[model samples]
Target chain A: MFAPRTNRLAVLARDWLRRAVPRSVRVEWVRLRRLPRWILEAPLMARARVEDPRRDYPICLAWHESPLQRGLFEGETELERGKAINVAIAASRLDGVRVDRFQVLSYHHLVGRPSRRRGFAPGLELHAGEPAVGIGGGCCQVSNMLYLLALRGGMKIVERHRHALDLFPDRARSIPFGLGATVFYNAADLRFENPLPFPVLLRFDVRDGVLRGELRAPEPPDFRVEVYQEGHRFAREPDGWIRENWIRRRFSDLEGNELRDELVAHNRCRVCYEPTSTQTDEESRAAGPR
Target chain B: MLRALVKGAGLVAVARVPGGAAAYRRLTRDVLGTQRGHVEKLRRVVPGYVEIWRQTLERPLEGARIWIHEAGWTAYWPAVCYRLSGRAGAVTNCEGRIHDQYLSRAIAGAIATEIPNDLNDPRRIRRLRALLWARQSDELFRTLEGTLHERCVPTNLPLADASRDLCHSGGVLEHYRPDELAAFARECRRVLKPGAIASHVLDHRDHLWHADKAYPFLGHLALAEPLYQLLHGHRRSLSYHNRLSPEEVVALFEREGFRCLALRRLVLPERIYLDADEAARRGAPGLSRRYLAPRHRAISEADLRTAAAHYLFQKS
Candidate 1:
């Protein structure tokens, strides 16, 4: 369902790099090690590419093009996936970066599923989203998680938005607001730019129900990078359940200090108590006296 | 006036006469002569804060570049000339009266609430006035001495042939009648450089009068009553006919081509009022009024909200 889409993304990425690099700047392409399941899996295999391989540039990775891209992942035709990837290519140009290629490893089956069910396996427990038939329900987390990794790697953010509410209570490992990415065709997108002079290698892998991202670059100088929280809270209420969260951030030595804070969402709820028909012995005795 | 004069003379006669009926009349004449002598002595020494009548004689002469108004008594003009121009400058009575001009009853009554029985007595009251008036005149004369020809004139002439940067009159403007005020404003405008800033601390509508009117109920009461006439007898008020409101003062400045900047009200402390009252009891009414009215009978906060208004202006 997603294989041909991955190949089309790779082709679109190639076309993007061909057009994005300024004629004055030289361009090169390099391939990183590919996992077998990510590269040759049932639905689609993942592949990575680097632009300006000789000079250092930050690498950005995303799961799908848009909410419309969800249709492609759900067994939509190659033409539909092509259209979605084209929108991403056009959007990526806004940041002055080339979209090399996005590799989709498999359909995220756990998406749109509730976090708990009776007797559900402990390892297979889905942590985000409700059990519902949808296209882009849980895909935001993948992009959100990736966005945090990019920010921590000291990459310049191009566009991002916080969730309407926090879906996860444990935000220590979560992406900060203005740091998380959201992409819906022609509506929202996760974008970043490479500010460094050197090329950055973006490596992605999913293990033990966790998605991990790694950035590889040539060592410039021995400078320390620290991530600090500014102690801000963001509260979100989904339906009737309330969740409070915080944002995490990183600071680089060259840039002095940086702060990450979250905005809280307010909720209004009212409770009304009604009298019951039951009468106690005391009430009955008081009634007789009255 | 006759009763006061006769009773005053009779009191003096009683104080001096020690013998029979014939001596009484003789004592009366002697007391009257003594009173006249005291008046003459006062005429020679009591400084008047304003000299409105002397404007004509003190007109500036040719080659006079700086005109200092109100050269206070005891205002060491020689020292002032040395300090300002390193040479002597012409000294003139621009506005204020010499110490001798304020010797009469009218000026005394206008200045002090209590007239001492023996007005000839020299005390701190007389000395302080002389000192202050002298200080003021000295400051003015010294500032302009030797730099420019001095004149004791009321003419509103510009500082001709000299580059004028500042045109300031601290205690001079409030003495002007409405027309004089307007003319003074015009003169200041004519003399000052464009965009020059003028700082003036002027009393508009005698602070005591304003306080009295603003807090009529309070002014009649014990705590605030004594403040009513406190500032009434100062030479600044007696020498000047018109008292302006803050708004009117600002309007006058604006009419003279000045833009208003800031207006601040300063409240006199209680101790100053006590000192003035004590001085008034000692026979210096003007000094007493100058210090007391703003201190004691001055309006309360609520009254201030109603009566208080002062302004600053820049020459446009």
Candidate 2:
């Protein structure tokens, strides 16, 4: 159910509104409005928390690293470096944390509120579908890496959040688009539960300007998990150009025999920046609606 | 603008001559030689350069692995700094130009004789005297080889990730386009360890004013984008300026995840007339609002007149 030409008109109107107002004003306003919800959700999240600080002889399972900085789109401010600081602050809280069997590990529960008093810095963050700079902005990078680690380690995702808008052009993207998980404290979070009997330790570090995360266990796993992206494509929809992909998870035995294959996530996000000429030309040729 | 038009035309004419490619290459070399003061100017300027870095860093630079962008033929800035202060632990000169063996040694030899004897450090002075006594016969290059790593790369850096503690450059930022600068900033973030710093010296004034007195210091800002590109694009092989304001320069790196620590600006006394309005009051031909591109047109007069700046940025 898409209305033709509506996407382009809405985009133009949104852009006009954005230019009319100052970004700092808009960001401060949004932060002020989100404060009440953030305060109320703090105790609600503490109700189901599980503390698993017991460490065992570690067996590393899955590891992933994402760069803290990426090439920015035109007119966008340079908040990525600030984001790196935020990521480090948030990632340190996640490091060495272990999730026990049937225990739900909420991202906000561990990282807490990314408040200035907690040493979080101003960084690029998306608020209400618009990119803005706010306190504890780049914490999503930590959640994104943790999500990837959880998926590859065969953990069950309890709750996750994805961005509605893809904000940047892919300059040196290693993973498929729409793979990152966005987090905004208690309202939007990444939560995963340990399905296996053994505890899974989460290790994170901001090493060499990359957010590195590793999933570890007490003993070697009999099965190895792998993730593959399928049917990755961009489409011109009524609202805007949208990027979509299917994340497929495969379970393999230690001896390399395939055990099971299953669909993990189907992601779709509206493209914020204009597609490059080649993408535009390709989309124009195959599209039903302009 | 006229000077750029003439220079551009002359370059085109020179290309039409026999063996013109070689001739034009030599001309570009001469341009760099005169403008950059290749080696002779190095001995005089190296000490001041080191002092500026010292003041800005507020600490000793000893044992810091430094990656210098666009270290020219001699790479003598770091070379002399290494020899004199003994501060740098290692130096890697990343340049787009191929390293010249004979020229480097010769330049090192010549710079050795010109080393100021009034220097404070007796050990450094003794080292210089030893070089002169030995006739500098490849001793400098051999010593530098032990600590200095020079590699010619067009885009990507050859160093390992998080290997360098400091990434620095002088008079180089304006030469890169916005996209190229964005890529370079990303590379800097990738190579430098977290909390490491990048120090850059930028000259925002028009380069044409260096040689030609006819061109105003802010004349480049007055030209139309198309006309400016036509005269000074990459094919010109001259000093092509991207004409970014100091704020824009800082923002470009910041966008690539660099946090600005210190920005020291220098506005020359002569260019005090911020924009055309101030210039009109003074009855001088100044940068006009009408002539500037729409992007440049909106810039504040304070930003328009910034002649140079030293930026100290830290990797997050």
Model 1 chain A worst lDDT window (10 residues): A118-127
Going through the candidates in order, their DockQ values are: 0.00, 0.00
Model 1, A44-123: lDDT tens digits are 21123555533654333222111332331345344343333332322222222222212111112112121223111111
Q: Write the per-residue lDDT of candidate 1 for residues B153-236, one digit (tens) a residue.
A: 444452542234333343456556667778766766666556554545454323234323332211212223233224232232
Q: What is the C-alpha local distance difference test score of candidate 2?
A: 0.65
lDDT score for residue B213 of model 2: 60
The clash count for each model shown is 21, 2
lDDT of 2 by residue, B38-57 (tens): 55554554455556556555
Give candidate 1's error at residue A113 in angstroms.
99
Local distance difference test, each candidate:
0.36, 0.65
- Residue B212, candidate 2: C-alpha displacement in angstroms: 0.8
